[model samples]
Target: MLKHSQIWRAIDRLAESKGLSPSGLARRAGLDSTTFNKSKRTTREGKPRWPSTESIAKILQATNTSLAEFTALVEGDGIGRPAPQTLPLIGFAQAGQAGYFDDAGWPVGAGWDEIRTPEVTDPHAYALEVSGDSMQPVYRDGDILVVAPDEAPRRGDRVVVRTMEGEVMVKELLRLSEKRVELKSLNPVHDDRSLAREQVEWIARVLWVSQ
Candidate 1:
């Protein structure tokens, strides 16, 4: 669950990362200087008042930060920069081909290249070179998607799913039930998908995108 304190702390950390104060962040976002003031974080009765989604969006755009990165901050997932880590890399087009991944979706076999991603700690992590416009407006063509096959996919998390029919796709996980998994398309024009549990060969959480 997301907490109001986490959102505010993420804002503070974001401001600090950019060498700005809360007021400066707000101002840079074209919002009032007092928009993020500590005094306004609560009501007169002392209840927590969360920041507006619009405000968060504005600050993210102002800081040139990705939502995944910001979510990481909110979740406190990053623990400073660790040594660079290398992972097996393959193109999105090749993901559907056999021999690249095991039955459990872990990367395997030859024809795989290597990519260095900072702070990626998953030993089973792999990179997929995104192609085409099917996942645009979020993941662009040529963007590198870091996938953690070991991480469990949660609702609203970006994920990679491979069907038993040899199709690989990236979509937002919508719902997971005993019988089926629902996915929401990243591109508005693309239709959503619903796959039976048996039809889904594997599902992995997308940790982040390196654009």
Candidate 2:
């Protein structure tokens, strides 16, 4: 039997996968903004209130998702259930320090915090909290950036590059070649840099950011 909490969690996950809040999802489904609000999950008398099939159908349509995909969500296989997806989170300042990441630019060792995020394709993806104003305008301090080490960054994509010398930077890719790569800093105050491909320990693509 389907539990109330499980179904509600599946809705929550559906919203997250589309990068929308619960209220956003409800609005997109042509319902009241508070339809899926946590407070509405139960009645005034504290009895659990379940989402109607009609509402679920509306949401699935709004998200351009199929019933099978929604069912997979309910089963915790597509995106959301009760349990959360955990990712290693580290501050940008601390990330520059040694021992936090392996030579391949994947998170390793200790001094790392865990954050629960929605399902992503890359199992090795990690989160980095912006600390300084170096990446302002586009990304501010306190923003969370999700990096996928296994994803190769294409030209014009934002990426995080770590050097063999322990220098870590977030920049936009201008050009890449067999021997070197050109990078443009997000902040105009910072000058663009070019590094030999050999000098870079690893370059990971920034998949998502929470402002």
Candidate 3:
């Protein structure tokens, strides 16, 4: 028996797996932004409104999800199950400020949002929303980047570096040594920067990016 609640929950889970809000998923599917909104899920009298089969099909196609996979979710069978872990999400602008992270670079304190993403190797993985045009061409405003604090960044890996002076930046690791680290900007208009090792508070590798 297919329950309405189960189907709706499966849709919500699908959106989460893609690192999107329900409206984001709808927009990706070429549907109205409010198509899957909570308010649209019920009538003015509070009656449950079911999702159309066409809408479900469109979302599945847009997300590249198979019907079998979506069915498993609706049936609670766990096929192609999403990551069980939830990561803390903060804007890149706010990440530079103090009190958001502890000494180890793990997220701390309030004002942090949450997102469900695929399983990350690092338990200290977190997400940052790109803001402004600093990292443009590679990362734009509203893009979400998943970073792993526990993973050591090697040469050529994209990384997020925080300085003791409360400056945070995303750059590609060009070189590293006991004395200083060289960072390359993703945008050609920006110049490369070098920071002394002692000045860096933490350096975390960017594991994934959701545009």
Alpha-carbon TM-score of each model against the true structure = 0.61, 0.60, 0.60
Off by over 4 Å in 2: 1-84
Clashes of 2: 0
lDDT of 3 by residue, 45-78 (tens): 3245789999999999999999999997776555
- For residue 121, what is the lDDT in candidate 2? 46
lDDT of model 2, residue 66: 93
Clashes of 3: 0
List per-candidate RMSD values in Å: 15.2, 16.3, 18.0
lDDT of 2 by residue, 59-149 (tens): 9999999998888877767755334378889999898898998655668899999987887645457999998899988899999999976
**Model 1 lDDT on a 0 to 1 scale:** 0.81
Candidate lDDT (C-alpha), each: 0.81, 0.81, 0.81
Model 1 stretches astray by more than 4 angstroms: 1-84
Question: What lDDT does model 3 reach?
Answer: 0.81
